[model samples]
Target: MRIGLYATGQAGLEGIVEDIAAAERLGLDSAFLPQLTAWDALTVAALAGPRVPRIGLGTAVVRTYAQHPLALAGQALTAQAATGGRLTLGIGPSHREIVEGGYGLSYDRPARHVREYLQALRPLLRGESTDFRGETLSVSGTVDVPGAEPPPVLVSALGPVLLGIAGELADGTVTVWAGPEVLGEYVVPKITDAAKRAGRPAPRVVASAMLSVTADPDRVRADIRGRFGTAGEFASYRRLLRQQGKAGLEDTVAAGDEDFVAATVARFAAAGVTDLLVSPVGTDEERERTLAFAARLR
Candidate 1:
C-alpha cells in the first residue's frame, strides 16, 4: 500500500506544514489537502510545496461547483508548474448543501456537468484551443496553459455511474468511507468493467478514511468521534455511508486499534487501491503513533 495521511480537518495548514517533513521522513507516500471553510486547496499546496521534498501532493476533493472546468484546469496546471510538477487535482461536483445552500450554485445535472467539464479541461491542458459544447458547459476560446504537464486527474466517484464516467474520462478514481472489502466486492468491479469496455489502459483507485489506533483504543475512538462529530449529526453523511454500507462504521475510526487500522489499510491495498489515505487525529501523540505505525510498514 502507498500509505499517506489526510490533512485532518481540525488541523490548520500551519499544523499540516509542521507535520509534512516528518511524514516524508517517516516514509509515508504523500499528504492529501482538503478544501474546507478556513483553508483553500491551492494556497495550501503552494505553501507546503517547497517545504516537503518529493512528497506527493493531492486534493482529496475540490468542489467543482465553485468554478468552470476550464478555469479549474488552468489553476491546477499552473500550480503543478510551481510545484515542479507534483500536484494531483482530485475533483467532484460537491454535495447539495455546499453547492446549493452555501455557494448558491445549481446542483442539477451534476454528472452531465462533470462530463462537460472534463471534455473542455482535457484539451485545454494539452495546449490546444477548445471549442466544445455540452449540456452543462460551452467554451469557444484558446485555453493554452504553458509549462503545465498532464497531471493525473482522479475523480471522486463512489457509485457505478460515476465510476464508469471516471474510467471513461479520467486517469483514476478516489473513494472515501468505502471500506476495502466493499471495494473488492463492489467499486473495483464497476471501474474495471468500465475500463475494459472503454478499451482504456488500467486506471488507478485511491481509497481513504479515518482509522484510529492508540494504547487506549477507547480514547482514540473518542477522538475520532470528536473529530468527525459534525459528520455524524448530518443526514447526508448518514446517507452517504449507508449507500456504501458504512453508516454504522462512521465510528470505525473511533473503535479501531493499531491492528484494526493496519488491517483496514491492508484490505484497501489487497482490493487494488493504488493509494491508501489515512486520516490520523490531529494530536502530537496520535501523529507520533501514526508515524511509528507507518515506519513499521516501511
Candidate 2:
C-alpha cells in the first residue's frame, strides 16, 4: 500500500507551502490539507499547486454547504488548471453540528443535498453549459473556464445513504478515523456495494489514519496531547474509536515500540486500506520521523 503524511496546514501559509515542497522532495505521495478554521480547500490547493507538480493535491473534504456548486466548480477548475491536473476534489456535507452550529447552515437532507450539489457541479466542471434545478441546488448558467480538466472528485462517505450518493456521483471515497473492524466490516463493503449497485466501477477508498510516533512511547503520547488533544478528542471521533475496539481511550495514536507501530499500520493495510495517509499527531520532529518510518514501510 502507498503511504504518506497528512498535515493540518497550521504552520503559517508560506511556511506550510514550503513544508509541502520539502515533503515532495522527500518522495511523499501527496498531501491532504484540511479546511478547518483555515481558508477554503480550493484556496490552499491554488496556493500549493504551483509549488509542487509531482505530488497530488486534494481537499481532505470541503464542506458542501459552505459554497455554491458553480463557485466550487469554478475554484476546482482554476486549481486543476493551476496544478496541471494534479488536483483531486474531495467534497462533502459536513456533520450536522458543524453545519447547523458552526456555519449556521441547514443540516437537513444531507444525502439529497450532496446528490443535488454534484448534479449541478459536475457538468460545470466539464465546461458544459446547462441549467439544473434540484431540491437543494439550482444552477442557471455555466462556469466558463476554457480548457479545464475536471479533477477526479472524491466524496467523504460515512453513512450508507451518503455512501450511495458518493458512489453514484464521485470517483472515490475519502475515509477517516475508522479502525480495522469498522472499515472492513462496515465502510468498505458499503462503498463497494454502492458503486456496484450504481453500475459504476469500483472507486478508490483512501483511508487516512492518524498516528503519534516518537523514539519514546511516553513522549509520543505527550506529543499527541500537545498537537491533537484539542481537536482529536472531538466527541464524534471518540465514539467511532470506541466502536472500533478502542473504547475509553484518551487517544487513538501509535505511540509504542516499532513492533507496536508497525502492527497498527499493518492492520490497516490488511483491512483493505489502499491509500494510507498517516496524520502525524505530535511535535514536528516526531511527525517527520514518523514519515521517515512510513517511507521505510512503503
Candidate 3:
C-alpha cells in the first residue's frame, strides 16, 4: 500500500510546504492537505508541487457545496497544471451540520447533489465542454488549462448510494473513521462491486486514520478523544463506528508501541486499502516518531 502524510496545515502555509518536502525526503508516496477553515488545499498543492518535485500532492477533500463546478474545475485544472500533472482532486458534499449550519446551504438529497456535481465536474476537468442539467446542479462551460492533465478524482463516500455514485462517476473513494473490518467487509466490497458493474477499473480505497507511536498509548488515545471526540457525534461517523463494533472516535485511533502500531497499519493493508493517509497524533516528539515509522512502511 502507498503511505502518505496527512498535512493538516496547522503550522501555516510555509509549514505545510515544509511538511510536504519532509514527506518526500522520507520516501513517502504523497502528502494530502485538508480543506479546513484556513488555507486552500488546492492552492497549497500548486505551491508545494513545484518545490517537492516527486511526491504526489492531493486534497483530502474540498467541500463541493462551497464552489460551483465551473469555478472548481478551473481552479483544480490550474492547480493540476501548476503541479505538473501530480494532483489528485478529492471532493465531497460534507455533512449537513457543516453545510447547513456553517455554509447555510441545504443538505437535502446529498447523493443527488454529488451525482450531478460529478456529471458536471468530470467532463470539465478533462478539458471538454460540459452541458449538464440535473435536479441539483446545472453547468454549461469548459475549463481550459494548458498543459494540465485531468487529475484523478476521489469522492468521500460513506453510504451505499454515494458509493455507487463514486464508483460509477469518480475514480475511487476516500474515507475516514472507518476501521479495517468496515473497509474489508463493507466499504471495499461495495465500491468495488459498483465499479465492476460500471465496467470501470478497480477502484482505489484511500483510508485516513489517526496514529501515534507512544509508550503511553492509553494517554495518547485519551488526548485524541479530548481533542476530536466530537467527530464521533457526527451521524455518518457514528454509523461507521457502529459498523466497526466501535463506540467512539478514540476507538478508531491506532496509538500504541512500535509493534502494535505496525500491526494496526498492517491490518489496514490486509483489508485492501490502496492508500493510507496517516494523521499523526500526540506530542511533537511522538508525532515525528510516528511519521518516521510510517515512512519505513513505504
Candidate 4:
C-alpha cells in the first residue's frame, strides 16, 4: 500500500510546502492538501508542485458546491501541467453545515447534485467539450488545457449512494473516520462491485486516519475529543462513527506506540486500502516522532 501525508490545516503555505518536501525526502508516496477555511488547495498544490519533485499531489477534497466543474477543471489541469501531471483531483459535496452556513448555498439533494456535477466534470477534465444537461446542474462548454492530460479524480464518498457514484465515474473514494471494519464490510465491497458492473477498472480506496505514536493513549484520546468534538455534529461523520461503534471522533483515532500503530495501518492495508493518508496528531515532539516512524514504514 502507498503511504502519504495530509498536508493541510496547518499555519502557512511555506511550512506546508516544506513539510511536503520533507515527506518526499522521506520517500512518502504523496501529499494531500485539504480545502477548508484556509488557503485554496489547488493554489497550494501549484506553489508546492515545483518545490517537491517526486511525490504525488492531491486535494483531499475540494467542495463541489462552491466551485463550478469547468472552473475547477481548468485549475486542476493547470496544476497537473505545473506538477508534471502528478495531480489527483478529489472532489465532493461537503457537509450541509459548510454548504449552507459557510458558503450560503442551499444543500438540497446533495447526492443528485454530485451525480450531475460529475456528469459535467468528467469530460471537461479529459479535454472534451461538455454538452450535457442535468436537473441540478447544466454546463455546455469545454476547457482547453494544453499539455494537460486527465488527472485522476477521487470523490469523498462516505455513504452508499455517493460511493456508487465514485466507483462508477471517478477513480475512487477518499475517506476519513471510517476504519478497517467499515472499509472491509461496507465500503470496499459496494464500490468494487459497482465498478465491476460499470465495466470500469478497480476503484482506489484512499483511507485517512488521525494517527499518533504516544505512550499515553488516554491523554491523546481526550485531547482529540476536546479539539474535534464538533465533527460528531455532522450527519455523515456521525453515521460513520456509529458504524465503527464509536460516539466520538477521538475513539476512532489510531494511537499507540510503534507496534500498535504499525498493526493498525496493516489492518487498513488488508482491508483493501490502496493509499493511506496519515494525519499525525499531537504535540510537536509527538508529531516528529510519528513522522520519523512513519517514514520507516515506507
In order, candidate lDDTs are: 0.74, 0.77, 0.92, 0.90
Model 2 over residues 1-298: C-alpha lDDT tens digits? 6676565776788877876787687787877777777666678778888888888888888888988988888889998888878888888887776888898988888889999998888888898886998988788778877777988888887778877888888887887767667777887788888889889888777777767556666666665567556544555566576677764333566675557778888987887767777776557776777777776777
* Candidate 2 residue pairs in backbone clash: none
By lDDT: ranked, best first: 3, 4, 2, 1
Q: List the residue pairs that clash in candidate 3.
A: none
How does residue 131 of candidate 1 score in lDDT? 93
Q: Number of clashing pairs, model 4?
A: 0
Model 1 TM-score, all chains together: 0.91
Q: Give the TM-score of candidate 4.
A: 0.98
Q: Least accurate stretch of 10 residues (summed lDDT) in model 1?
A: 247-256
Quote the positional error of residue 159 for candidate 3 in Å: 0.9
What digit string (tens of lDDT, one per residue) describes model 1 on residues 30-107?
Answer: 888887677778667767888886888888788877877677777888777767788888888777777888998788
lDDT of 4 by residue, 1-298 (tens): 8999988657587889998998898899999999988889999998898899889999989999999888998999999999999999989999999999988999999999998998899999989989987888789899998999899999999899999999898889999888988998899999998899899999999988888999888888999999889978899998888788997999988889999999898999999999999888888788778877887886
State residue 236's C-alpha deviation in candidate 1, in Å: 6.4
Worst 10 residues of 4 by lDDT: 6-15
Specify the highest-lDDT model's number.
3
Where does candidate 2 have its weakest 10-residue lDDT segment?
A: 247-256
